[model samples]
Target: MRLLPWTGAGGKPCYLSTDDPHSPLSRLADDIEALHLADAAGVLEGARAVLDDPGAGEHAVRFALARAVESLGDTLRVAVSRGECA
Candidate 1:
């Protein structure tokens, strides 16, 4: 059982049961995980910029925080899916 990067309906975690790593669904999951990781990298950079700005407003900080939290979740999921985390 492999945990997919995205959730199912009602925010439940989705899993993939397959032996073929190159299967269509497996490939799709791999592609989506890659996208999530890439997006997380960009989000981390933006969040750092926002935090480093002394003049950044509350709204800007909050928005950056929200995006950072979301990206963190995605990145964690990817890690778990790849067996990088225990």
Candidate 2:
């Protein structure tokens, strides 16, 4: 069973049960995962910039933090789906 990157209704984890990793759904999941990782990289950079800026306001920091948290969740989900977690 391969855990998909996206959740189902009610925020439940979705899984793919297939021997063919190249199947349509599997490919879609792979693509989405790649996107999530790419977005995470950008979010990390932006968050760092916000944190390093002394002139940044609370709103700016909070926004960056929210995005970072969201990206972190996505990245963690991808890791778990890929069996990278211990």
* All candidates: TM-score: 0.95, 0.97
User: Per-residue lDDT tens digits of candidate 1, residues 1-86?
Assistant: 99998899999999999999999999999999999999998999999999999999999999999999999999999999889986
Best candidate, lDDT:
2
Alpha-carbon shift of residue 10 in model 1 (angstroms): 1.1
Query: Model 1, poorest ten-residue lDDT window?
Result: 77-86
TM-score for predicted model 2 compared with the true structure: 0.97
> lDDT (0-100) at residue 40 of candidate 1?
91
- Which residue pairs show backbone clashes in model 1? none
